[model samples]
Target: MKLICYLSLGSPSLEQSKINAQNYIDAGCDVVEVDFPAKDPYLDSPYIQSRMAEALASCDDYSEYMKTIEAIKAKNPNANFIVLTYENTIREIGISDFIDFCKRNHLKDIICVGNTHPEVRKELISNDLLISTYVQYHLIPEEVEVAQNTNGFIYLQAKSGGKYHDEYKDLKSIIRHLREDVKISNPIYCGVGISTPDDVAMVKAAGADGAFVGSTVLKLQEKPTELKEKIVALKART
Candidate 1:
């Protein structure tokens, strides 16, 4: 299973984010999803929100974020990078400019939190950037269509609500529904509170292509060794 780790641009520091990105790459994360610090990360939990807030306060502009991407790419040219940010940040930077920046930096995949619409979808694709969206419990026709159209893995949110901390619900049935009913051929990645090797194994057993982990990995910020160990264990399970 592909392991996707979340790292914030400004959290700790832009330089430190680069260090952590390299560390995670060395530790065996297939993709490091970098979050562009936002004033209000509506989809994130308090743990991540606080760190993003710190990052926003410390960094003067998006230059550090661009530099972080460059540094990570320098460390590993084949490293996979995904940007998980709000729409305002993308719009503030200007869609065309953002697309050009990502293209120049070799970044492609993006998860636009709090913004899932036709225009957002159209703009990303027009610039040759891939888009990703969430798949919840109730699969609406439009949601299924989005999942079918996304280039990367279909993000299967393993929870019910957008509260402080969402509980992980069993996704076997949801995955089944997506595959059988919706005919979603894109890779499915179950995430949200997926912290254990057992959780990763469960996703793999349920026919998912990978596991997306963020909060749990972020909690190990102070313990680099443990973080690597956890990632190794998670990868082994796959």
Candidate 2:
């Protein structure tokens, strides 16, 4: 099973963010989901929102952010990176330009969250960019269609934040539906509320291909040893 770690560019500090990224990769993360700081990261949890705010406050320049990512990539030559950002960010930099930027940086996977139009998704896919399809607790028909059509992995939410959907009783059932009913062969990675080794074990048991741990890893950023141990423990479950 893969372990994906989330890192906000320039969070805390550009130098420290690079350190954290290296630590996460060294600790056994298969992929790092890097987020470009946004003014309003409304979809994310409070923990992630604060990190993005910190990142923007430190450095809002896209070039600097790209340089930081480039530096990180230079250091970790074999590490996999997937870009995660809001649609507004992409709009700020034209879609074609953004695709060029990603290509130059060798980033093939992208997760453009928030109300993005289907045409935008199609354009990205047409340009050979792999974009994730999010599968929330509530399995709506539109989302199912997106999942079926996605060329990238499926991002499955592990925690519903309080909302309940009767279509699927549990994560396992949801996984089953995606596999059997939806006929989605792409990797399904479970995120949101994933923190502990137990959570990783639960996701693995639920038949997810991977687990994404973000807030918990960010919380331990100041403590490098503990953070590394935590990632090691989480990866062990997979």
Candidate 3:
């Protein structure tokens, strides 16, 4: 299973973000999700929003974030990297310009948590960048359509909105509906409050491609060894 670790760039500090990302990669994370700190990330829960706020307050500039990406790539040449951000960030930089920057930096995947218009999706596809969007717990017809047309994968978020247990059924149901009902074959990644190795196993067993661990890792920032162990365990479970 693909283990994607979500981290906010420049959170607490850029140096710390770099260190955390390196630790995640070393811990067996297949992908490190770099979040562009937005002023308002509505799709995120309180913990993630707080992290983004802290990151934005410390460094609002995207230049340092871009450099962080380059630095991470330099040290971990084979590590897969994806940017998770709101649409406002893309609009601010202009879509084509953003795609050019991603191409130059070798960042191929983009998970637009917000601001997913058909035109924007089309443009990103034209640039050949892998595009992903969230699939909410309460599946909507529109989201099913979006899933069918995604360039990369589908991010499945639970309804409860935070890291918790008992979401396996919900996740399984959604993936089944999308795959069996909607007949969309995109890779479905379960996120939003998934933390433990058991959680990862449950999702993967339920037909998900992987689990996106975000807030849990951030919470373990001070405990690097424990965090690494957690990531390693999650990877092992798959």
Candidate 4:
């Protein structure tokens, strides 16, 4: 199982964000999902929203954000990275410009947090960029179709809000359904509400190919040792 860590670029400070990325890479994260700080990150949890807000306050320039990612990549030459941003950011940067920027930076994978238009998807595919498919616990037919067609991993939301639902709780069955019923062969990665080693274990046990962890990892940015420990523990579960 892969351990994917999320980090908001320029959070706190660019230098500190670089350090955090390096720490996570050294601690055995297979992939780091770098988020472009947005003025409003509505889809994220409070922890992420706060961090992104701080990141934007520090530096909202898209070029500067890509520079930071480049620096981190230079240090960890083999480390994998996936860009995470909202559709609004894409529109703000201009889709073609965004694609060019990512290509120039060697960033091949993206997880756009809002509805991506078909034209945008077609353009991304033509540019050889992989776009992740997101599936909620509700299991709508449209979501299943998207999952079936994606070349990238399917991002399965573990939980939406503070509330709980049986379908959400039964991730194993959901995974099975996606594979058997929906005929989606893409790797399924569960995120949201995954914050601990045990949570990582649970996702792995449920047959997920990977787990995306954010808030829990971000909360320990100040304590590098603790953060490394947490990452190592989480990776061990994989």
Candidate 5:
């Protein structure tokens, strides 16, 4: 199994997001997720917005997202980046062109939320499926069909909605069931409500092929090398 860390680019200041990504890379996270900023209005989280404002103040333009990837890859050539974000920007920017650009530049993947646009299918390479997570709820089943047809993996959310608090004691069985219900071998990764190395253990036991960590990782200190070590230790526990 592999791991993908969500790196806040659109949603977070470039500096902070890069710092967070470097931390996870150091901790042994298998992959990274680069999400767009202030995406969900319902968050109604003033505090979140406040934090986001600070992050975005220093954020780079969307075009720099790819440049940053190349820079990071130059340093950590083995690491892969997932261009995690909402789908609208893609449409605005021209999906086909972006997909071609990503492949040409060597980006690992793109994870989209709140959409399954018919046109989205043309974004990835000939056989790349648009990755979906459980955050969308009630949409996974239909989305899975898209996954099957589009060649994208079905990413499962392991925990309940909202951030993963320390209160979430154990959820291995639940993760297992989600994977089984999906009933496919096409790379299922669980995310949301995960905090700590133990959570990684639970998801692995649950039969997930990989795990996704975002806010939890951002809460961690910067330092990609060390972060990767921590991730490896946690991942091995399962």
Candidate 6:
């Protein structure tokens, strides 16, 4: 079973991502999902920006992003880095630019969460982007069909919006439908609200090809070494 750890480096510096990467590597995680807000409504609002770096940090700028990526790579050279972008920002930048960036980095995968075909396909869907969709919970067979049409991986979010849980009861039904009904042959990975070592076991047993754990790992800031150890333990399960 492969465990993909989501690293939300919600910080002013690249410190969180760097630490998360090192821990993820040590923990035996198969990949490290590097996420940045594609667009945050509160970024423009001073009230929230005062509290959250993801709300206040200037991570969207290309230079800052590149620097952060370099720091993360330094920490774990072999760790798979899948960049997670929100649909809005990706469409805004033009899909071509996004594809070009991923190709340049040799990323095995790149995902546009909450994105639609009409918003992206015209630009470079046929290119080698290796995209993934975030239908999350409440998926339709067509959503799986659309993702299949792109010939990319499927990102099954465990909840509505972005939330985590100990066990998502809906996941099994959704995965079963997507597999048996939609005939989705590509890889199936789950994200959202996965926060603990035990949660990892639940998803893996639910027939998920992998699980993306974010908040728990990111919050393990002061004790990255310990956090990575836990992750590695989960990776060894089953």
- Work out the TM-score per prediction: 0.89, 0.94, 0.89, 0.92, 0.73, 0.77
Give the per-residue lDDT digits (tens) of candidate 4, residues 80-153.
99999887888777889899888887888888777645677677778898889988876766887888888778
- Predicted structure with the largest TM-score when compared to the true one: 2
Tell me the whole-model lDDT of each prediction, alpha carbons only: 0.78, 0.87, 0.81, 0.86, 0.59, 0.65
Model 5 Cα lDDT, one tens digit per residue, 1-238: 7876666553444555556666777766777766555434234246445545554466535566656666666777778777655566566556776676676767645666445574564545454534553433233456545645444556666775643424322355444444465455567777766667888877787777777765655544454555566667766664
Model 2 clashing residue pairs (backbone): none
Return the candidate ranking by lDDT, descending. Answer: 2, 4, 3, 1, 6, 5
Among all windows of ten consecutive residues in candidate 2, which has the lowest summed lDDT? 114-123
Candidate 1: residue pairs that collide = none
Residue-level lDDT of model 1, residues 80-102, one tens digit each, is 87788788777776777778888
Compute the lDDT for candidate 4: 0.86
Cα lDDT over the full model 6 = 0.65
Off by over 4 Å in 5: 10-19, 38-53, 125-130, 133-150, 160-182, 222-233
Model 6, 40-106: lDDT tens digits are: 5332234223324552364556545656776667656667877766656666665676667666666
Q: Please count the clashing residue pairs in each candidate, in the order shown.
A: 0, 0, 1, 0, 20, 3
Candidate 1 residue 30 C-alpha distance from true site, Å: 1.1
Flag regions of model 6 displaced more than 4 Å: 41-60, 74-77, 91-97, 114-121, 159-170
lDDT score, candidate 2: 0.87
